[model samples]
Target chain A: METIVLGIGETLVRDDRHWASWANWLGVPAHTLSALVGAAVAQGRDATDALRVLRPGMDVDEAYLARAAAGRGEHLDESDLYPDVRPALAELRAAGIRVVVAGNGTVRAGERLRALDLPADLVVTSDEWGVRKPDPAFFARVVEVSGAKPGATLYVGDHPADDLFPAAAAGLRTAHLRRGPYGHWWAEHPDVVGTADFRVNALPELVGVVGGSPARPGAEPHSARPAFEDGTGAVGGARPARVSYLRGL
Target chain B: METIVLGIGETLVRDDRHWASWANWLGVPAHTLSALVGAAVAQGRDATDALRVLRPGMDVDEAYLARAAAGRGEHLDESDLYPDVRPALAELRAAGIRVVVAGNGTVRAGERLRALDLPADLVVTSDEWGVRKPDPAFFARVVEVSGAKPGATLYVGDHPADDLFPAAAAGLRTAHLRRGPYGHWWAEHPDVVGTADFRVNALPELVGVVGGSPARPGAEPHSARPAFEDGTGAVGGARPARVSYLRGL
Candidate 1:
C-alpha cells in the first residue's frame, strides 16, 4: 500500500485578489509595491531583472503593486489553504503515505510554506526543477521525489486548468477542491465524483482518505474512531494535537 | 441581399440586480401588482408557465418577498438597463446585417430585446420551437425558419455551453457576447476559439465581421461606403459575416 499525496501550484506570497482585499483593509492600494516586489524577491528575481524584460519603466515593487491592484496573482494562506478543512499530509505520512508540495517558485514556495510551517516529507519547487505541474515533466519530478508511480498518486488542487485536467492527462487520479473559488460553472458540474472523488467540504476531511478515524472540533470522521474527546482535534478530524499541526495555504 | 434574422431564448420576466436601484421610483414593493409580480419573479422559471415547471410549489409572490428581504432578486423595470454600453441592435440590422438572439427560454431573451425593442428582423422563441440554442437541432430550426444555411448564420449569445460550443460544432459562425449573467471564464478565455470559440466584447462588433463596418447609432450601410472606417476589416477582403451567414453548421 504505497500511497503518495501531492499538491502543486504557484505559491506566491499572496494572490492578486487577496492583495486587493488586504489593500482594502489597509486603506492602501494592495496591488502595489508589496505583491510584485515580494514575488520577485522571493523568486530570486530582482527589480532590475523584471524591468529588463517586461515593462522597463516599472520597477519590482511597482510591478507587484500594479498587478495586485489589478487583481491578477494566485495567493493562498493557511486559513484559505482550505477553510473549514485540515491539510491531510500528516495523517497520510503517519500511515506511511508520502506527501509532497510542488510549486512554481522555490523561494516563494519556501517563504509561504515556512510562513505556514506545514509538515511535509518533501516540497518540490518549479524554479529549481525548471517545470511546473500539468506538464508531465512536473509530475515526473513529483514521481521521482516522492518515488510513487503516477497511477498510485493523487493530485489535489483547486484550479481546473492547473489541477484537474492536467493531472488527469498525466495518468494521476485527481481530487478537485470545489469548495474554493472554482467559479459557478465548475461548481455546477455534476460529475464532481461526490463520493468517488473524495469530495470534501473542507481540508480536515483529508484524514478520511488515508483511513484515519479521528474526531475533530465538531464533525466526526465518516468511518473512524473519535480522535479527540472535546474541541482539541483539527477542524477536519479529531487526533491528538501532537499528531496534528495546522498549516496555512 | 435578403437578410433574415431569427432570435431565440426565454423572454423571462424576472428581477435583476439593477431593479433594486429603481425600487423607490417604481413605488417600492408596497403596491403595483404587475410590478410586484414582476419583482417577485426572479427568473424565466418564475414566468407564468416556466416557473411552474421549475419550482412547482414555490409561490412567485412569496419568493419575491423572501428574496427582497434577503437583498437579492430585486426588480428591474425598462429603465434600469444601463452601463450605457449595450450595443444598439437595431442599427446593426438597419445596416443590412441580420441578428439572431437564441436562448433556452425566449421569454427572458424576448423581454430583454422587446424592452429595448431594438428592432431585429425576426424573433424566434425556444418554447414555441421546443429547441434551444447550443443544440445543433435548435440552430437547424433557426435555419429552417429563416431559410439561412448554418455556415451563413451567425449566433451571438452569452452562454458558452448553450451558445458557442454547439454553434461552432454545428458550423454556424459564432460570436460570443461578453454580457448577461453567464460567467466571465468563457469570455476572458485567452484561446476563445478553442472552447465555445470566436469571441468579442460586445454585440455590434459582429458587423465588422461581414462586409460592413462597426455599426454605431445611425451609421450608413456598408454599400454606400468605399470600405471600413480604417484598415481594420474582415480578413482577405471577404465579407466574413456574409460568408459566415451563408455556411452550414
Candidate 2:
C-alpha cells in the first residue's frame, strides 16, 4: 500500500485558469461560464456540456481550433497547481511512496505537467490513453501503470463520479479530496463520503496518508488512517470517511 | 504485488557478445576470459575482478574508451536477448504485470535496453542511480521505483550473489535464474537455492509465477507459486525454491 495515484484537474492543478480562458474565448461573462460549469457538475454531467449549453449545436472540436488560432492554446504553468502540491508530492516521493498522476487531461496538459517537474514518478492523461475516467478500462489502466494490486494502490481525486466511485468499483482504494467546484458541491454526496478511504481537503494531507512520514507544509492530520487498513484485497464493504471541509468554504 | 523487477545481464540478454568483445579488446582467448569470469563468480568475487586478473593493473575505464575508439564501444541489438524474453515480457505486460528492468548495467547499456523497446514499464541501470547491486540501497531503490511495498515486490536474476541473495536480504522476493556462467555455477550455491522464492531456467517460465495467466510461448510451468503465497510482509525467513535446471545445461 505504498502507492498513491491522483487525478489531475482538481486534485493536483486548479482548473480556474483553464475554465476562465475558455470563458474569455467564448465571449461570455466568466461568472456565466462558472455557473454553467457548476450546474453541470451538480447534475453529474461532463463539464464540456456547459460549453455546448452556451453555444448549442456548436462543434466542440472546431471551437477548440478557433480558440487556439486566436492565441490561448491550453497552457499549464506552475501557477495553475494548488499551492500545497509541490511540498506534498515531494514528501510523498521522499517517503518512498509511488506517486502517480492520472486523470482526464489532454496530451498537451500531460506534457505541461511533466515540464513543471513536480515530484511524481509517472504522470499520464485520459487523452493519452484514449479513454476517460469512470470507465472501468480507465481504472484498469491505472492499476496497470501503477504496477501494484488495486488494494495496494490508492486513487485520489476531487470528482466522485469520475474518480472515487468508479475507482472503488474497479477494486482500488479511494480518497475524495474536497477541492475545486465539483469537490465542494459533491463533498456531501452520500455515496462518495460513504465509499472513500480518506476524505481530505488540502493536497499536503497526503503526506499523512502514507506511513512513517511527517505531515508536509499545510497538512492538517485529520480523518485518513493507515493505507493498508482494508488489507490486500479489493473494497468489499463501505469504509467511509467524513468530509471535514464543512466549515471552510 | 503485481510488479516483477528483473536483472538484465543473464535474465533477459545473453552476455556472450559483451564478454567476447571485451576479450577481443584485451587480446585474450574468449574461453580464457569466460573461464576467468566463471572462476570469479565461483569465489563470490565481483565479475570485474576477472578483467583485472586477465591484465594486471589494467585501467578498465581506459579499456572501455579504447574499445569505443575501435568502433565497438558498446552494442546491444535484438540478438543479444534470449529468444524467450520477448514472449515472456509481452505476456507479463499484457497480463498487467508491472515489469521493471533494474540491474548492474552501465548507462549506455541501459539506453541500449530501452532502445530495444522490450515490454518493460521501466528500464534503469546502476549507473543511472550511482549505485550497484548487492547494495541494500540499490534494492531499496527497486522498491521505491516499483511504488510497491517490499513485501509485494519480486526481484529476479541469474546471479545468486548479486541478484538472489542480496535481494532476498533486502526484503524482496527472490528468484534464481540458472542462465549464464554465473547462473550455472551459482545454481548449486547452498545459500541462494535455499532462499529464493522461485528458481527458474528460462525467462518464459515467469508467466506461471503471477496469477491467472497462460504460459508464454516457450514457458514450462514448473516451480513458482502464487505471488502472495507468503502474504504481504518482508522476507523474515528463508522460502526456498529448488533449481530445477538439472537437465538442460
Best by TM-score: 2
Extract clashing residue pairs from model 2. none
DockQ for all models: 0.02, 0.00
Question: Candidate 2 has what TM-score?
Answer: 0.45
Task: Pick the lDDT winner.
Answer: 2
Q: Estimate the overall C-alpha local distance difference test score of candidate 1.
A: 0.43
Judged by DockQ cut-offs, the docking class of candidate 1 is: incorrect
- In the range B1-249, model 1's lDDT, one tens digit per residue, is 223232332121222333323333232211111222221221111223223222336575576556657676443344443232235456566667665544554344455555655456555457557775556788677666544666556666655556665665666655565443231222443223343223444444445544442222344334222123333433212223322211111
**Which portions of model 1 miss their true places by more than 4 Å?**
A1-80, A86-100, A103-124, A128-131, A134-202, A208-249, B1-85, B88-90, B93-100, B106-109, B116-125, B134-202, B208-249
Cα lDDT tens digits, model 2, B34-56, are: 44454344444556666776566
iRMSD computed for candidate 2: 32.9
